[model samples]
Target chain A: MANDKSSMQLVANGILKENPIFRLALSMCPAVGISTTVMNGFMLGVAVLFVQVCSSLTISMVKKVIHPRIRIPTYTLTIATWVTVIDMVLAAYMPEAYAKMGIFVKLIVAFAIITMRLEMFACKEPVGASFWDGLGMGLGFMIGMMTIGLVRELLGSGAILGYDVLGFKPLLFFILPSAGFFVVGLMMAFFNYIELYYKRKKGFKS
Target chain B: MKNIITIIIRLTLSCLLAAFVMGIFFVMTSKAKKHNEHVNEEKVMYSLLGYKVGAPVPETVKLYAVYRYIVTDPAGKSIGYLVPTGQGAETGFSFIILDLDGKLIEQKPVTVTADDAAEAESRDKAIKAALGAGKEAVYADDKTIIVTDNGARTAYLLSGKFAGFKASISVMLALKTDFGIRGLAIVEHEEDPGLGAEIEKGYFKNQFIGKSFATLKTLDVVKEPLPDAYAKAMEGVKGEDGGKILEQYKDHAIYALTGATISSRAVTNGVKGTVAKFAYRINILDNVLKEQHIVVPF
Candidate 1:
């Protein structure tokens, strides 16, 4: 599926067509859980991006040596190693950011998006292609999180990235976990609508 | 058999390599991580003492840490407290040995090397030596910090922990010499954001300031809506205005957060208990010092 596509197309595909959160519905836990604020979403997004890219690269490079029976364990180990290294480095160098993202950083290992990419794409692709795929998927997830965060933060608290934008909360419910489902569901429908419009324009049947 | 063996060997090697890489990073960053934590702690301590971040702490404003330890017998029965004299000692550690009834037994200084101070084992060894046989000093989780601004006792900082909505919330409070709260900082908590987490907001925390120990003992978390004017003032009032605003509400109980009364009550109760215990403990310590005629530098 990835052989005919150029690297840029692979990235665009991840961002729009096969978007982790919006389209593919992967890693919904964090997308719903931490997307209460733009900063949280952005921070978790950056951490996940770093881990995803590193894990994908490592798996692709070592795929030749890893036994088929043990590839899942190997992939798990690679993801865990990158997450720990990032967690420690952030704690040491960027403590303020770490304070916000610390809990989420460790949880990235359990994220289905990273592991799924490794299994479906990274392990089968060449090193360079796997790197591009990882980057695209990571960026897609980051964008998805930030989009959810933006809507939640603005509506719930009447703030944007912690800055008081509306001076008064429009809907306190938006900040709650329940609101996350509503936003994600509405966003999915909106994206699906756009996709349907484009498909129809290209004379494609539903 | 050969294929299975290869698979096992490959899996083991991959695990080993991952562990090795993680170990390298952990060892390399452990020191820096510790340093960062120490700095963050000091920053919190200083901020609670009304010092601004990024600015150097003034020489005149000194903070002396008084480590408190409960001296226990071999059977784990509590005996007494081994407290530092806080004499501004430049060398060695000076401790005031007190019996269970707060009777002064002896004042002794344990000469511990700089290297030995970092390790708990060596420090325990020194403490054991000073404490004599059959008694051991167990470090208390709470810390009592004396803040002196130009040799005058300005504030007493105490660390306290209380049960919150999800987990224990650790808070550091700075109290005036008269036992009125000067300021407070939430050191750590895992409360739910946008609900119980509002306890960390300045509007919520600043209300505790200027509340005397007497007021604090009886302080309640009121479910009534917080007045808009007072809320705005509590958000960012300073100097005489802030003092006046706080004084006006000095007798007022804490206003519970909209959806976080449990957390709000937790902090109010925690502060009250912490201050009550500190006041009681400090009174005893003061009496001991006065009886012993030991002059605490701060």
Candidate 2:
């Protein structure tokens, strides 16, 4: 406890250093499914943001009572409850969008990333730190998925967020689920390249 | 005891704050959302009328009056009223507009935002086919003039333009009725992106051209005969006993999709149902007030 990092450090770590999708490779279920469209990706990001912030703060507050044997279930329940609230609100208001992203929204319950964060970071951190950390992680995941959607929309359909970029004739394969894998792989590789460039410039030995 | 109370208060306060913020967000976005929905409804109405005229923005002005004038056949009989109906298709709510005479005015293309890549591609293909076949028409970008459906038949309507993702199919019969579809735009749907979503394709919509109500009712790829009421009406025309009613829909038969029976049926029935409902209203026109007829010059 004496040697622990600051609250700001925890927040920064979640956003970049310990990013949930790119760095830690978690929550791939929704990440892959909703990444097909920018609208779906954006909404799913908001849902994750809500879940991460609420669950992190709850788990931190209840960390003292949670026994090792029951910790995972408790964390999952907390996450699921937050997801359900967002899901209901979306269904009632944005029925069109909610209808399109159905089933995948409900599957937020089994997202292992939320539980992993609760166990690894939130339990030991202060509530304030945990909340910020969770927010950063959720944002990072959102950015990753949205980036993929943006690329797929632009390349596959020749549009980004409905704005046509390339000639109207688009490469149709870019929007397919199989295409998602190729784009993700290339994106992950790009992220690695950026990380390596900064490390090399800083003269860090591997 | 004090610490326990403090923790409970903190949790409650946080939850309440989140809820309050979300509530405020809803209030702020509600008006714009409602306007978007209203615009979509008008687009649906315009698609079925089968004639291409540009749609006005729904948010700025409400459509207080929308009606179809039934054009009888050479025998001088009244047909059904043409009205618009929305249906679930690949991209969202693709529409088929019809009037009482069993004449399909037009089909409106699917309206989509560029967000969903799969829907966009499918919608584009559908619109292209509809226009290329001269089954639909649209207001071309950079040109204020209303181009014929032939303009769309060769090139994509939404080809180079990007703003709001929308597809509309408009049909025009030789009959000189001013009442026609203004647009058909989809609001929402989860049709299989490529294949099942082909309903938005204009070719499927164009097949309804020149289909009479009697024939549409008995519409089968197998070329079945009309149902009892419709056959009787046809017989009345041929027997020289029927006057106005038999001639109204004698030429309009509903067309059926070969592969997508249910989807085609849904659209065909929707057209028939709307026309029937509107015709019923027109029959009791004395009871239906024209809300926009009161012209107040300020």
Candidate 3:
């Protein structure tokens, strides 16, 4: 199935056609929980991106050796190992960024997005194809998180990336966790609307 | 059976490989991680002493860490405290043992090797061995820091922790020689962002500054809104003007965060308890030092 599409197409598929956040709706917890500020969203996005790519690549490489019965455990172990290594590296080299992203970095292990990719795409795809798929999905999640964070931070705190843009909070309700569901739902609908618009423009059936 | 055996071997081999890879990274990063932690702690200490980050600490400013241990009998009854005396290399690595009543029991030299000091278990073992059988010196619950500028005592810093909205919040508070608060830094917490997390904001933390031990004893968290003037001053103004605004509210209760009164109260009560305990402990330490006629090297 991967051979039917070029590597670039695979990446685009992950970003648009099967976007992890808005379309597949994988890992919605972090998308809502940590998307209070753009900086948080960006930091967590980078962490997830790194972990996803590394774990996907590792799983694809070792797919043959992993027993079918134990593949799930192996994938979990691989993801956890990468997360720990990345966590330590960030703590040592990027202390300031680490201070902000430390807790979220550890939380990446529990993100269904990374594990789902390994099981569904990486286990069957070639190494290079798996890498591109991971990148695409990671980028998709990052963009989704940043978009949510931008809206929430702007409306909730009247700030963008911590700089005051509106000078006063116009809608403090946007910062609450309940606002997260509304934002995600609206974003999903917006993406679907765009997709439907393009499909109809192409003269495709609904 | 044959297929099962092969699968088990593969799983075992993969697990071993994962462990091996993790072990290499752990070794490569452990030293750098330790160094980073040490530097971060030094930064916290300097900040607590009112030294701004990025500016070099002046040569005249010195910090002395006094490690206090509660020496307990085998039955867990607290018998005394083992406090190290002197500073830097001047330390003969000797500990002055004082009973609960602040009477000096003995001054004994305990050798803590360089390697043993790196690990807590080994270090505890060495200290325990020196104390002989049936006596254990458990480390104190809080940190005691003495800040000196030139030859004069400038401040005393203490670290304490208390339950906040989600988890325990660790804070390091600086106090003037007379026990008035100088500043406070929230070292770590798990409070929610945009709400309980606002406790770390300057406007909230600065409220604790300039509050005397007397004021702290009765300090409470009030639901009353923070005065707009004081809030603006706390967030923007620094130096003398900010001090005046904080002083004006010195007698007032802490202004609770709009949706985080629990966190606000937690920090206020935590600071109050920390100061009260530090005052009592320091008083005992001072009397014991005077009675022993041993000039503290810091």
TM-score of chain A of each: 0.97, 0.92, 0.96
- DockQ for every model comes to 0.78, 0.04, 0.62
Q: State which candidate has the highest DockQ.
A: 1
Query: Over the stretch B200-279, how does candidate 2's per-residue lDDT look in tens digits?
Result: 54544434443544454455442343344444543333444444443464354433433344555555554444434433
Over A1-206, each residue of candidate 3 has an lDDT whose tens digit, in order, gives 65677889988988888888899998988888889999889888888999999999999998888889888889989999999988888888888778766888898989999999999999999999999999998888888899999999998889999999898978878888789889999999998999899999999986
Highest lDDT among the candidates is held by which one? 1
- Which of the two candidates, 2 or 3, achieves a greater DockQ against the reference? 3
lDDT of 3 at A94: 82
TM-score for all predictions? Answer: 0.93, 0.51, 0.93
Q: Output DockQ, candidate 1.
A: 0.78
Residue B58, model 2, lDDT:
34
Model 2, range A1-206, lDDT digits (tens) per residue? 43277767766777788877778878776676668767768878778878888889888997876655556656766776677667766765676677567677788878877888888878988888788788888887778778888887777667777666786736667766778778887888888899999999999963
Docking class of 3: medium
Estimate the TM-score for candidate 3: 0.93
Residue lDDT tens for model 1, B95-151: 666666667766777666645644567866887887688777787665688888887
The predictions' CA RMSDs to the true structure, in order, are 2.5, 18.0, 2.5
RMSD of 2: 18.0
Error of 3 at B262 (Å): 1.2
| Model 2 spans with C-alpha error above 4 angstroms | B1-188, B193-298
Candidate 2 chain A weakest lDDT stretch, 10 residues: A1-10
**What is the lDDT for B207 in model 3?**
86
